[model samples]
Target: MVEEKEKREDLPPVNFSMFILSLNTSALVHLGELPDPHSQQKKKDLALARQTIDILDMLKEKTRGNLTREEEKLLDTILYELRMIYLRVSGGK
Candidate 1:
């Protein structure tokens, strides 16, 4: 029991970017079939999506015109999806 508890404690704390990356990875692995919309996991997904949008906004400001065409496209897609998720969570105005 002590060893199991220690192992659990040794795991890293999930952060915004890490959580987003995890969601992305899991979504890809599962072909985008995520948890129930009202589940706690969904809440984490929403939070991660918001954080991803904030990070991308900062990156856009910091690297404007410095990214390759493909990079720009990818960032645009990510930002758009994040915005959609944000609006859904915020009760679409």
Candidate 2:
């Protein structure tokens, strides 16, 4: 476990921005916009994608007035892009 811990420690410090990006990556994977890390294949899981998007939305609502200007802009832009992609992928349903 020492080796694993050392590897993880080399990663960037976890912060709100990092957290948001992680969720963004997950949503992209679920939406088939990016390949799944484990499977190395792009697959559409609209339900999962929607859930991830909703989680980001909830974070935006909950963190209202708490995020820095840059952070807030990142969240808004990501949410909007994801929703648009979702609509197109889901046939606007």
Candidate 3:
């Protein structure tokens, strides 16, 4: 709908930071740190969480030295937080 499109247009512009944030959100949802948007229920899917985390890690490695300080810090913080949460949720496995 035109109204829906207009609402979406109000969203933040796509960028590296937004991309990373989106992945972070997905990881959180998989880790049960956040509810699944569609189901509105919390669920743990360790494998999927790990996969999403790995994707972020891969991006960090592939984009090293190219990201701005803020972006780098954001990625590092997100990765560290997610890893800690994952460990806690997975019994430190």
Candidate 4:
């Protein structure tokens, strides 16, 4: 039983939003280029942007006054841009 408990603890946490946030943060850090850059870098940025939207979808359920006003607004802007990027990537009308 003790071994089982330890194993469970080693598993990823149940907070999907937090997981997504972590992924987004990592992607953003590695996403070199913005506002104008090489094609390859732009591709990376687009991928990160889509990932960020997915993160926002998860965050929508988790954020509830846990963030400051500025933080929330920042998240909102990220979500908006991500959605736009995702739409474009998906070939939106």
Cα lDDT of model 3 by residue, 1-93, tens digit: 999999999999999999999999999999999999999999999999999999999999999999999999999999999999999999999
* Predicted candidate 1 versus true structure: per-residue lDDT over 16-90, tens digit per residue: 444445544443222223554444243234445555567667876787798777666766666676667567655
TM-score, every prediction: 0.49, 0.95, 0.96, 0.46
Q: How many steric overlaps are in each model, in order?
A: 0, 0, 0, 0
Q: Name the better of 3 and 4 by TM-score.
A: 3
- Give every collision pair in model 3: none
Task: Evaluate residue 20 in candidate 4 and report its C-alpha lDDT on the 0 to 100 scale.
Answer: 49
Residue by residue across 23-92, what tens digits does model 4's lDDT show?
Answer: 5554454343242223334334556555656667667658857876766666676667656645655576
Comparing 1 with 2 on lDDT, the higher-scoring candidate is 2
Sliding window of 10 residues with minimal summed lDDT for model 2: 84-93
Residue 10's lDDT within candidate 1 is 93
lDDT score of residue 76 within candidate 2: 99
Query: What lDDT score is found at residue 22 in candidate 3?
Result: 99
In model 4, the Cα lDDT at residue 83 comes to 61
